[model samples]
Target: MYPSSALGEFLRSRRARLQPEELGLPGGVRRRRVAGLRREELAPLAGVSVGYYIRLEQGQAPNVSDEVLDALARTLRLDADERRHLHRLARIPQAQTSLPPTEVLRPGLSHMVEAFTDAPAIAVGRRGDILAWNPLAHALLAPHWPVMPTGRPPNFVRIDFLELAFARSLYADWAAKARDDVAYLQVSVSNFPGDEQLLAFIAELKELSPEFRELWAEHPVSNCATIAREYRHPQVGAMTLAAELLRPPDDEGQGVTVFQAEPGSVSQDRLRRLAELTSGSAA
Candidate 1:
């Protein structure tokens, strides 16, 4: 079929938002019957025939040309992210027979995590899969989990949005923080086109929340080098933490993210106390 379910949904979403009147076409002087502009209307707007547009929409078009895709993008007035998504869906190659696990932490990177003894540090792949995390990192991040799973990868993006108590309780600047996190993840997705896992994760998020779909369409980018975050520590109360993202040497495919509270501040005090409470809990 088409690369994934996301393609049909993406096109339909765009098509459902346009109007013939908006395209400078006659509104037929009669009431419109369709929810959005019909395929025939879009074909003329995109400078393509209705039959061809129908084939494209129905997932029957094979090896769709970039020029035609660009024409459709222009006609739809797609934003940068939506245009990129269109291109991605149309061009995603077949999955490899033996695709390797994208998450793997290097030794030197592991050492860096250890070096940040007091800071909460985590190593994540391009797809946001947590490959490794330091002790304090676990303490800063894991309070959200109802029960910590043994030796399993935790998806940071999923926990942020899906976990009700965690998003509401732990994160203080929740909306802004969520947007930044999603923007960062989008950048990673853009960097690695045709990564099946990344594509599937984006598809999953798109289905899970309309807000995410809207944000993803905006195509924001965040480097994650530094961020201001507020965390409510069950033990020490609320603390604002400065998040840091570190990319190791070229050989390492993963990046390390550390959250540190300002020294001598209330957040610092809370982080220290919380760290003490979970001292030996790291598995």
Candidate 2:
């Protein structure tokens, strides 16, 4: 979808989730063709002309003022992240949709990922594609799929959705993790609105997984960083791993994320065992 299309879709979806009664309107779902407030109701509340608001929703409005956007954001109950997404879709210049070259692993970062023997560390490209990973990360995240000699890299979003059985076995809260995967993609797209390759990738995944389609339509917004990953590891039983996301100053939509088990915790012990198993096999 184009940036305007994304903008329109986002506005429509957010409005659909709200009820007229919630805003102290008299209708109470009366005379309402849809579930949410109508354009007329929203326009007046946000201090804009009804025609202008309609144009904005349809992506026909060439320009929108920040004051208006702020009002609309407030009316729609948008969070900080969602508000940022709204602004970008409305104002930021669109990046070229042509597929860029394959993402290369930066030198020091690849070494950095490999250096983390005690924890799961990975170099993550856009949309959570695995660029480089240490042995523990390999064992922790995608043990079933052996590392490819050469091909498209393994993407965590695709794995989290299409590989349902494995994901469920890995994450204690599989449903939340699946939703988070979708949301991360949503946030990433704000950087390259209407990117053909990225859009096609997401569209294909949505087609492949019904669960993904359901979550994608919700338009959840979040970055890839996770506070904790509650793992139900088949080998080590259970582990609650904390994450630290590393984005360099010259970030090009790539970063390193490490998952660590707290020192002296049972999770740390299990992680050590997992590490031994992964490294010993390699040796």
Candidate 3:
């Protein structure tokens, strides 16, 4: 979808989720044809004209002021991330810059991953490509696939959506994870519109996976930094771990994701067991 349409859809979706009563507005005696606050009802509350609000929601408003955007965000009760996304969508001069090529993990980053002997750590590029990963991460995320050399990268998006059986076996909530991946991709595409590799990757995914096509149409945008993910491992059974995403300084679009379990928990015990199994297999 175009950025303007995305902005409109996001506004409509958020507006539809709020109730008149929740906004401290009296529910009128008249029967409502649509859900949530009407444009006229919301306009006054946001200190904007009904005509202007309608134009904004219809993606026809040009050069929307930051004051108006912030007012709308507050009126809609948007969370921090959602508010940022709204600003990105509504801002004028939506400049598109070509992103740099994928980066390999620096030596210090490789060392950092190695230090996490008990945790699974991987370095990922902008387009969800696995740039470098520690042995534990390899065992956790892709034991079947060989770890490639520095220049070549393995992509998480392809493996998750295109390889259904593997993805279903790996993630306990495969559908949710898949949707998150697609949503992240959508946000990435919006941010880096001039990235040819990203465009090609998305085109390839859309052509290959009908499921991806359906999810992409929903226009979900998210930048999830931490997630509680469940993995069904052949050696360690079911384990729930918190995946933390860390972007290294000056790494551009690359990020280091580390998965860890609570100390002294059953998940931790499983992780330790998995580490031992991976070590033994390597030996």
Clashes of each: 1, 0, 0
Whose TM-score is higher: candidate 1's or candidate 3's? 3
Encode model 2's per-residue lDDT on 152-263: one tens digit a residue: 8888988998888899989999988887777778877777654566777898987898899888888887665656879988888899998787888886678889999889
Which of candidates 2 and 3 is the stronger one according to lDDT?
Answer: 2
lDDT of 3 by residue, 97-160 (tens): 6656654556776677767877899877778988778888999998888866544577888899
How much does candidate 3 score in TM-score? 0.83
Query: lDDT at 248 for candidate 3?
Result: 73
Tens-digit lDDT track of model 1 for 33-93: 7567788888887888999887777667768899989999998888776677678667655
Ranking by lDDT: 2, 3, 1
Where model 2 places Cα greater than 4 Å from the true spot, the runs are 27-31, 92-101
Q: State which candidate, 1 or 2, has the greater lDDT.
A: 2
Worst 10 residues of 1 by lDDT: 92-101
TM-score of every prediction relative to native: 0.63, 0.92, 0.83
Clashing pairs in 2: none
**Would you list the C-alpha lDDT of every candidate in the order shown?**
0.72, 0.82, 0.82
